[model samples]
Structures are given as C-alpha cells and as structure tokens.
Target: MSREPTRAAILIRESRKRAGLTQQALAEKLGITTSAVCNYESGASFPKAEMVFGLCDILDLTPRDLFECE
Candidate 1:
C-alpha cells in the first residue's frame, strides 16, 4: 500500500536540508546506508530512539524540533 510521509519523515528531510546535508551525507554521518535515510525520509520505516538522537545531533536540532516539526 502507498503510505503518506509521516511527520518524522518531513522533519528529517527538512532538517537535513537545513543542515545542508544530502541523504548520502547524512547516512555517512549516521553510519547507516543511504537507503536507510531514504526509508526514514519516505516514512517507509521509523527510526529507533538512538537514531532520533543521532539525527538531532547531526541536523543541529533538538529532539523537540525533530518531534514537533517546529
């Protein structure tokens, strides 16, 4: 089934862009595969808690920013 992108997906994608990092670059920083980043951005899967923190750090954002999409 086609799934709409989740809030987390939008947050990750926007934050990554704000940080000026491409999916490949973000994946390298997160030590994950590019497809993993794509999957998260596409809302095909959710990131683990640790990954959330990692994203916060790499994206120069807070958990609140990532979670609340503010």
Candidate 2:
C-alpha cells in the first residue's frame, strides 16, 4: 500500500525543485549531510521543529505555505 505524503516531504520536494537544487545543494545550505536530506525525502525520518523553520528560511517558504495549512 502507498503511504500518504507528508507535509515536510512535499514541501522539501517542491522547494528543491523550484530552486533547481539537488539534494546535495540543499544539504549544503542546511549544513547537513546529503544523506540526511535523502533520508528525509524518502520518509526515513523527519527534521525537528527548529529545523523545520530553518528549512523554511533556506527554501524561501513561509511555514504556512510549507505546511499547506489554513
């Protein structure tokens, strides 16, 4: 069965695509390993709350937009 897409995963995917960024590039911006970014995208794990905000800053996305929340 297919799992539902997570907000974080969707946001990360969209932001990276919009920026024309590879996981390695975004990982560099986050000061994290590329493997971590890969894992997050693969839904192997998730970032912390602070990292969520950090991702928003790096990705030029508002938290509401990133989460697609009302």
Candidate 3:
C-alpha cells in the first residue's frame, strides 16, 4: 500500500483538478505561492497541518477523502 503522505498528495492534486482549479488559483485562495501548490501536487512537500482544513475547503474535499487512499 502507498503511504498516507504520498496518498495525501495525490488526493490533493486530484481534488484540485476536480474543482477546476489551477495551482495558481488554489495558491491565490490559500495566500500561498504557486510553487508551493506545485510542490504539494508533485509530492515534493506537504501542507502545514493548519492549512489542511482550508485546502480541503477549497478543493471541495473532506479530510477523510485526503487520507483514504489504498
């Protein structure tokens, strides 16, 4: 099975796509840099814990959705 951290990154990327958001757009909403979003989607980095809820809101995902990968 894939690790939760890796799965979280994939979930975030897929959720963002489903929401019709570009990295720049999600970054704008999160008040972060586009490169940060790129890094997250690329599995280069993870968001801070406090940022996860906001990310979920913007991506139209529940926290469970981000962590439920197999």
Best by TM-score: 1
1-70 per-residue lDDT for model 3 (tens digits): 5334477788888888999989999999999999998888877787887787899899888777766742
**TM-score for predicted model 2 compared with the true structure:** 0.73
Candidate 2, residues 1-63, lDDT tens digits: the string is 655557677777778889888999988988899998877676657776777787888778877
RMSD of each: 2.0, 2.6, 3.9
lDDT of each: 0.87, 0.76, 0.82
Model 1: per-residue Cα lDDT over 1-70, one tens digit each: 8888988788889989999999999999999999999999999987787888898888887887666752
Check candidate 1 and list the clashing pairs: none
Residue pairs with backbone overlap in model 3? none
Query: Ranking by TM-score, best first?
Result: 1, 3, 2
| Poorest lDDT segment (10 consecutive residues) of candidate 1 | 61-70
Candidate 3 — worst ten consecutive residues by lDDT sum?
1-10
RMSD value for candidate 2: 2.6
Q: Which stretches of candidate 2 lie over 4 Å from their true place?
A: 1-5, 66-70
The lDDT leader among the candidates is: 1
TM-score of each: 0.85, 0.73, 0.80
